[model samples]
Target: MSETPEKSAKASKSSQAAQPAATDKANSAAKPAKPAPKPKPEDKPFAAFINDDLLPALKQSLTERHQAPISLELVEGDRPVVGGNCWMVQGVLPSDRRFWLCFESDSITSGKTIALAETGSDPSLLESFLIDEKRINLALLQSRLLQRLNGQKWFGGN
Candidate 1:
């Protein structure tokens, strides 16, 4: 039996509306979507090592030894390692009252500064030490400092 034109038009409109709802439901079921979260900024890892741990340790060590007022200054420049910059520590030893300890980037090993002595009274002592690559070995610096502190040796085996 054929439906009347008016009834047929109403049925077609209802079907069209149902189709849209069905499509919407299908789309929602097809994929479970998650809301994307915003990315956080990368935090500097060496902040604690430089500011909290290393600086305080060095200062205390110097003070206990009765060395001159040890002042650690961060040297600003482009270094190969991230957050790797030279540290200049000025203090006096028991033997040599006026001295400077240079913690150059090249002289750092195993997360420790290889303290090097600034021998001359040149105005640019820090600059001179950095420029001379051969003298900045961390092991050598450690040995030299030990010797100096013990009054065993005058020069570091560079």
Candidate 2:
């Protein structure tokens, strides 16, 4: 015997509900995946400043003036300040010398306008440099360093 009217209506309702579920699964499977996001272009160049350009120039400057080698260790802050990476450097100047700290900033202006790469401590090395009648000028040294690295790649010198 043919199906009853009530049975046919029930079958029709069930098939209609099943259509949407099948359509949803097929739609999701057909879609392409989203691409991974790209990193900022500044990341590489800023890192170069820390490793290649700034650190070497700092070492050379210290060696020339102090007559011994210098080394820099990363002193990452709790959070980086805007406009650059966290390059707060703490190291030994002239090997086995006193601990020194350098706060990186473009705000510090010197002749020829190169990025500042120098260190300080709580009246330690800074105190010794002030001997000889408050002379042995730090600004002159800073200017000299900025001048030296003025044309090197990184620090936007190139």
Candidate 3:
């Protein structure tokens, strides 16, 4: 039983076709796919970020912790310590405890100053915080502020 040359040629052509497809599949599997680039976040002004994003976040955090929403407002006046104009967010707790969160400058790269005081009295807990300006966001601000307050035992701890 001798095989025909035509059948042999046909088998060879089919094998050749299958070989390339298999190689293509293997090559594709071997190479890693490039990842999609992450989208760049929109840069917002310091004042807008505070007023639109930070104030509400802080208020919500305080409300969740203290069971009453703290009043927060943006104020522009002389810095309490340096005597220069800056942005400040004043928060008044339900129990009459007051706190001031101040920025050293209008830029997001600036440092921060925070003070916690009783009503009608100077601040008893004053602290300065340095944050990564490039990565500043609502979550970071809220975390730092809450951490600072907790450190000072502001929410009823002695």
Task: List candidate 1 segments past 4 Å from native.
Answer: 1-44, 68-70, 78-120, 123-158
Candidate 2 wrongly placed segments (more than 4 Å): 1-44, 78-86, 94-158
Q: Mind giving the per-residue lDDT tens digits that candidate 1 earns over 54-134?
A: 445545655655553435544434332233454544444444433444444422432332233434432232222333334
| Candidate 3 TM-score over all chains jointly | 0.64
Clashing pairs in 1: none
Per-model TM-score, in order, reads 0.32, 0.31, 0.64
Best by TM-score: 3
- Full candidate order by lDDT, most accurate first: 3, 1, 2
For candidate 1, give the lDDT of residue 126: 25
lDDT for each residue of candidate 2 in 32-75, tens digit (9 for 90 to 100)? 87787764332335445455545565666656654344456545
Candidates sorted on TM-score, descending: 3, 1, 2
Worst 10 residues of 3 by lDDT: 37-46
Clashes of each: 0, 0, 0
Q: State the lDDT of candidate 3 residue by residue for 1-158, as single tens digits.
A: 87799999999999999999999999989888778775322256777777777787788788788735457888888666456788888888776777778887776557888878765777754577655456766677779878877776766685
Q: Which pairs clash inside model 3?
A: none
* Better by lDDT, candidate 2 or 1: 1
